[model samples]
Target: MDIITSHPRIVKMKKNDITLYISTFPLETEDDFLEKLKETFDVEEACDGKNMAECFAIIYGGIVISKNSIFKRIELEGYFKESDKGIEFEINRFLENPYNCYTFDNGTICFIKNKEKDSRFVDNVGLRFIIK
Candidate 1:
């Protein structure tokens, strides 16, 4: 299936709904991915994919947030709830994991979970590229 059409946001969006610009695409490499990210977000700065953590920094809600390889999941009493500009969804499936991309502090980029069930990063290209 086409990545954009099969994307959760695309599949779930309604005609008159307010939503955030969340989408996923095939990831190629840190450099290439950063290049693509620049197209949407005003990326202030990024770390060298080899040090501290393979992280990307962007301004969201007027705050700079960075995502790195460190991942921790909290148990939920029910399906995980996430909302964006009134758009919401219950997370219960592998595909419903919401965020898909993860980068290690060592410069490695991969899925945060269910790597097998998800797509693959082939020849420097990753399986998922997420924008939130």
Candidate 2:
């Protein structure tokens, strides 16, 4: 696994959805990360692996939210050939707009939220992204 300490916001929500705060630095080399993500998510390769090259930042977060009870489980058999990373699936219920979707090179889907310093949603969500 890559050194993900900087982006502590990446976490398991429930069991299917992943929500990521994209303002942080991007994850490891976009290519490698996407390859791992595609294998992790089990999404069929839509085109040649070349399509993955256009991804932006690497996102890490939970996919499952409270509204849905079903969990999106990701099989890690071929993705990580070594150590077994504890993977958790979660459902995402906070999506109010499709514009919030952020996709990495490998097809990892992350929901992003952009807010001001004094936004009430931030205060209520109690979300902290700092590594400390």
Question: Could you say which candidate leads in TM-score?
Answer: 2
Computed on alpha carbons, the lDDT of every model, listed in order, comes to 0.26, 0.26
Report the C-alpha lDDT of model 2 over 9-126, residue by residue, as the tens digit.
2222222233322222122333443454445543334223521211111132222222233223221111111112222222232233322323322333333254433221211111
| Model 1 pairs in collision | 27-126, 53-105
Worst 10 residues of 2 by lDDT: 74-83
The residue ranges of model 2 lying beyond 4 angstroms of the native Cα positions read 1-9, 15-24, 30-43, 46-132
TM-score for candidate 2, please give it.
0.18
Displacement of the residue 111 alpha carbon in candidate 1, Å:
17
In the range 32-86, model 1's lDDT, one tens digit per residue, is 4355445544333332342221221111111111223332222211111222223
- 67 in model 1: Cα distance from truth in Å? 24
